[model samples]
Target chain A: MKTYLKLAAPMALAAALAPVPAAAAWRLVDQGETRKVARSTLVVTAPEEWNRATERPSSRSEVWTQDGIALSELTFYAKIKDGETLFKRRQGKRNPLPEFDKDMLPTDLVEWYEDTANIVLGGSLFEIVEVTPATLAGYPGVHLRYSYTGGDNVARLGEARVAIIDEKLYLISFEAPRLHYFDRYIAGVRAMMDNARFK
Target chain B: MKRLLASAALIGLFAQPLLAQETGDETPEEKPLPSAHGYEPQDDLEKGLWYEMDEAEKSLKESRFLIEEPALNAYVRSVLCQTVGDERCAATRLYLLRTPQFNASMAPNGVVLVYSGLLLRMRDEAQLAAVLGHEFTHFEKQHSLRIFRQIRTKTDLLSWRSVVPVRLPYPAGMATQLAVLGSVYDFNRDMEREADAGSIEELVRAGYDPRAASAIWSQLGAEMDATAEERGHRSDKNRNGGLFATHPRSTDRMGRLAYLAREAAGDGAGELYRGAEEYRAAIGPWWAQLIEDQIALKDFGGTEYLLATLAGDDPLGWTGDLLYARGELYRARAEDGDFAQAADFYRQAIATGEFPAESWRGLGLSLMRAGQKPEGQAALRSYLELRPEAPDAALLASMAGEAAS
Candidate 1:
C-alpha cells in the first residue's frame, strides 16, 4: 500500500484537473483473475488488486491504479488503428497530438510515444533512458524506459511495451512517481505485461 | 501551493505597457536604484514573502526543468553581469529553465529564471541583455513587494465594495466596478513601463545596440501573427482588451521601444555591439537540443516562421542545422505532402555534410513515407552503417534489408 494522505492537497488538485468520473466509476480488479479491458480485444490477469479508472485517457485505453493516480497508474491500449491518437484530441487545440501509423517500426513507435509524453507533460523534461527489443504476448515488440516531470513538478518513471500486429497497435505502460512507488510496483507491472494476451 | 504557483506565474508575465495617452515624445530616462548590497527583508511582511520565495527557490534548484549545463549557465550569468554590474549580479541567482516559452522572471528573493525558449528566440547578446536588464531592474526596484501590497490592498477594497453597495446608474455602476479592477492592472502596467525605460538606459550604458531591444518585440509580434494566420483566428493581441491585459500588445511595445532606443542612441553615435557572432558561438553546442525543444512545442506555424527568419539572417544559403530543423518541423507535423517537404529539406541538409548523422535516418523515413522504396532503403542502410549502435539500429536494419545493399 502507498501513502496517500501525505500529498492529498496536490493530489486533489490534480484529480480536479483530470477527467475523473463519479466515485462509483472506480471498480476493483481482484488479483489473479483474467478480464477483458478497454472495450478492446486485450486481456490480462492482475498481479495485484487495483482500482480501475473508467475515465481512461483514450477510448481504447484503460487505467488501473494501486493508490491515487498521483502515485502509480498502469494503462493498456488495445487495437489502436492507424491515424488514431493515444488520447482524445482536446477541442480547439492548435497543435494536434501525434497519431499512430500502421507502417511504424518499433523505433518509430518509441519516438511517437516520446512526442506524446512531451505534449502531455507540457515541457521538454521528458527523456527516454533505454530502448530494447522485447515481446508482447510472445510476439516481437519494443520496450522503452523513460522519465518525465509532470505538471505537478514531480519526476515520474515510466516503462512501455509496444507492438503492432495486423495494422493495429497494442501498448502496455506503467508509470509512477520515481521516489518509491515506481520501484515498488515495477516488478508487478512487468509480470502483468508478460502475461497479457490478445483475446 | 496553488496560489503560490499562480502568483509566480503572474509575476513571470510582467512586461511594459503601451498606453494610448503617451504623446510620441520620448519618456524621461529612468535612473537606476543604488547597487543592491546586503539587501534583506526590512519588515515582517517582506520576511513572509521572502520565506515563500525561498521555498520555491529550493525546489527550483533541483527541478528537472533546469538546464544545468555549466557552459550555458556561465555564459548566461556573464550576460546578466554585463547587464547589471557584478555587484548586483552576485545578489541574484540565475536559472535557465528548459521551457518552450518566451519568458523570464525575477522573484522577490532574487531568483531569476530565463526560459530556454528565450535563448532560442534571441538573435544576439544585445537583445538578450535587453530582457535580462529589464528583469534585473524589477529586482532593483522591488516590484514584487510593491505588486504584492497593491494586490492585497485592492482585494480588501473589492471585498468592502461588494458588501457596502453605492447606488449608481446601470452602465455607470458597471463602469465603476471595471475602473476598480482596471486600477490593479494599471498599477502593474506602470511598473512594467518603468522597467522598460530603465533597461534601455542600462543597455545603452553597457555599450549594446539599443535598437536590438525593439527588434525582439518585432520578431515576437511577427511570430504571433504567423500563428494567428495559420490557426484562422484573430491574434491574441487583437482579442485581449488592453485594459484587462497586464501588458501592452507586442506591436505597441515594439514601437515604444524603437522610439526609446532612438532617443538613447542620440546623433552620430558609434556602432554599438550586437555580439551576434559571440552569441552564436555560445549557443552553438546546444543548437540541436534547443531546436528539438522548439519543434516539440508543435506550434507548426510559429516554428516555421522562426526557422525561415533564422535562415534569412544567413548570408549564403540555409545552414545545415537550419535545414535539419526545417525537415524535423515538417516531419513531425506529418500533414499531406509534408513527407516530401521533409525529404527535400533532409536531402539538402545531408548534402552539406555538416548535419547530424540522424539526417540520414530522417531522410530515409521521409522517403519511405513518400513511397520512394529503393532510395529509402539505401538511405536507411547508410544510417545503420553510420550509427551501427543506435537504439533502433536493429529494427532499421531489418526494415532496410539483411545488410548494406
Candidate 2:
C-alpha cells in the first residue's frame, strides 16, 4: 500500500537527484536560447540543448525532448480554458477525457491530471507520489510528482507545475524513465522550470 | 481496462473462452474428447503454427506485464492442476498478468495468460477452476489448430477467387465474402460450445461445484449491464444471441450451464467443494491492488455492483478489507457528496479491528475535502503514527499541520 502525497524534496535537493537523439522532424533549441511555446503566453530559456518535437501533443501544448518522447519528454500546456481538455477530442470515444474546470482547486486539478494520465497512457499503471503548493510562472500553483509504467511497462518518473490564472490553466511537465534518465536530466528540468515565465 | 498490449498484438497466439450456447447437438460432456499430449506437429501447416506460437510464447515470457510473484503463480497453478490432471497441467505454463481485465487466454503453444481482474470477479477456487478448465479444453480439443485450418482454407478460397478471370457481379461477390466470414464465426461459436461442455464435465469429475460455472457467467453479465447503464447506454440484453460476438450471450450461456449443472447433480452427492476461504487467503495480499486497478478504469457503476456483490456473498459479515475498498472507491470517484460518503466508509473501516493503515489516510483526505480539517488532521496524524516509515510520511505530516520533526 504505497499511498499518495509524499512531500517532494526542495528544488535544490531535486537538482542533486538528477540524454539525446536527433530526428528528421525535430529541431534543436540551443543552450541559453529563449523559446516561446503555447502561443507565446509561456516561454522558457533552454538551460541546455534540447530537441523540440515537430508535432505537438495538442494545439495548446509543445513537446521537447533530449531522447525520443518514449524515453523522455518536457511538455508545455498554455491557456487551456474551462470546458476544454488537455488533449484533442476523439469522436465516439466511449469514455470522454475529463474537462478542466475553472473552479478546481490545486488538489482537485492534481487528481484530475492523474485520472487523465491513467486514461491517456493506454491503461498504464499510474501512481501519484506527491503534491505541494508552489509558484508557477510567478502565480500560486501546485507541484506534482508521480510515476507510471506505460505500454512498455518501464517504470518512469514525472514532475509537473501547474497554475490557473484568469480561469485559464498553464502547466509545464517533464517525465523520463526512472533509471538513468530521471536522475540524469532532473537538474536540467529544474533549471528550465526556474527559467519559465509568462511572456 | 487491462492494457492487453502484448496479448492483442500476438493475434492468434491466444484464445479467449467466452461461455457457449446450447447448439442443439449432443452434449459434448456425454463423450469427452481424448486428452491432448505434449503436441508434436505432424504437418507443414501444424509446424508453421507451432513455430509462430513458440515465438509468441517467448515474447509473452519477457513481457513487462507478467506478474512474477512465485507464491501467487504456484497457487493458481495448483488450482489449474486440481481442475485438470497433473499430467495435463505439466504441458502448460501459466503466466499471471497485471492487467485489470476479466479474461484468461490460452495460446496454442501451452502458454496460459490469466489477467488479475478475473480473480476479483471469482468468489472461490471453484469459479477459478471453472475458467481454467474451459481454457484447458480449448487446448486439449485442438480448437486453435482447427480454427487455423478453417481460416487457412478461407484465405485460400479468397486467393483462388482473386486469381480467377471470371468475376461475379457486385452483390454476388459481396455475398460470397460475407458467407466466408460468417462460416468462420460459426465455426468459432461451435468450438466455444464444445469447450463449455468439456469444462462442466471436468468440474464434475474433479468434485468441484459445476454450478460455479453458471454463477460467474451471470455475475459478469450483470457487471457488463451495470457498466452500460453507467455509460447511459441501453442494455443490449435482447440482441439475437450477439450474431457477431465471439462467444454466445451471457444469458444464453448461463442458462444452459445451469441446466447442465442440475442434470449433473441429479443424485446430489456429498458436499461439493467451493474453497471460498482458500481463495480469499490466496488473494488477500493483492486484493487492494486489484481493487485499485479496477477502479482506475472509471467504471463506477460496475465497481459499485461488484463491491456490493462481494459484501453480500461474505457469510462472516463485512470485513475491514471490504469496508476500506468501498471507501477507496468513493474517494477515487470524487463526485458530488462522494467525499462525505468516502469519509464515512473510511471511519467504518477504521472501526474494524484489522483495518488497513491507508484507511486513516483516506479518512484524512476525505475529511479535509469535506471541510472537517481538525478531524482530518487528527486522522492523518494517526496514519503517520502507524506508518512512520511511509514513503510520503513527511508530506502527510505537513498536511497534518505538524511542526518539522
- Indicate the fraction of true inter-chain contacts that candidate 2 also forms: 0.06
Best by TM-score: 1
Model 1, CA-based lDDT: 0.70
Chain A accuracy as TM-score for every candidate: 0.87, 0.84
The per-candidate TM-score of the B chain, in the order shown, comes to 0.82, 0.81
Residue pairs of candidate 2 with colliding backbone atoms: A18-A183
TM-score of 1: 0.83
How many Å off is the CA of A73 in candidate 1?
A: 1.5
Error of 1 at B164 (Å): 24
Worst 10 residues of 2 chain B by lDDT: B166-175
Model 1 achieves a DockQ score of 0.27
True contacts kept of each: 0.22, 0.06
